[model samples]
Target: MNCTPIVRQHPDGQSINYYGVTLFDEQSSKSLKGIFTSWRNLFESAPNTFEITGNFVDWDNEQDGEYERININRDEVVNQLGKIISMSEHLAKGNCYLYHLGK
Candidate 1:
């Protein structure tokens, strides 16, 4: 498969280079870097398909703010949260560790 190079400006006005080497945006070239890695979470499947959520919570260690919060299980959430952070830093936005691809 052959792919043409695609360039677009990010929301921050920074230019991002994507050199397609496989098919469309499926693969990139040595000269360019893509928004997110194609491979991420391919084991645990979730509803949103992304491990991260939009729900914002200011984790202020200080007691001045909200004392505590509630969500999914603590241990489970902590584990999933770690994966989410690592994945988000790699992917652009839409995609996340919430969904799995394959084994």
Candidate 2:
């Protein structure tokens, strides 16, 4: 399968609008999980997640005396997203269920 850009961002001076560009895989189910994976990978994470390279705190949202959530790096997340978008045929066929654990 050929790879394509799954996201785009429109810059406006100091802010950007993130958008997803996706192509449905004929053999896979178009569930929310599938689409959300791509979205999270493309923009919902910081560029430097593990402090390995580049700016680490640029996009991360730290709690102001609220809850503590660790920062996530985008590169690793994107790699996983690639796996999701290009999911194996065998995986798609597994009888799996999606459930909400908490309200």
* Colliding residue pairs in candidate 1: 49-99, 50-98, 51-98
Per-residue lDDT over 1-103 for candidate 1, one digit per residue giving the tens place of the 0 to 100 score = 2223233332332233333112212122321222222222332233333333443445655444442443334345446555644554443333322232222
lDDT by residue for model 2 over 22-102, one digit each (tens)? Answer: 332333334434565657555556556643333334334553333335566677677776665455333356554222222
**Number of residue pairs clashing in candidate 2, backbone atoms closer than 3 angstroms, sequence gap of 3 or more or interchain:** 1
lDDT (C-alpha, whole model) for all candidates: 0.33, 0.43
Which sections of candidate 2 miss by over 4 Å?
1-28, 32-34, 44-46, 50-65, 88-103
Give the best candidate by TM-score: 2
Clashing pairs in 2: 49-73
Q: Candidate 2: global Cα-lDDT?
A: 0.43
TM-score of predicted model 1?
0.21
TM-score of each: 0.21, 0.34
Please report how far candidate 1 places residue 99 from its true position, in Å: 8.6
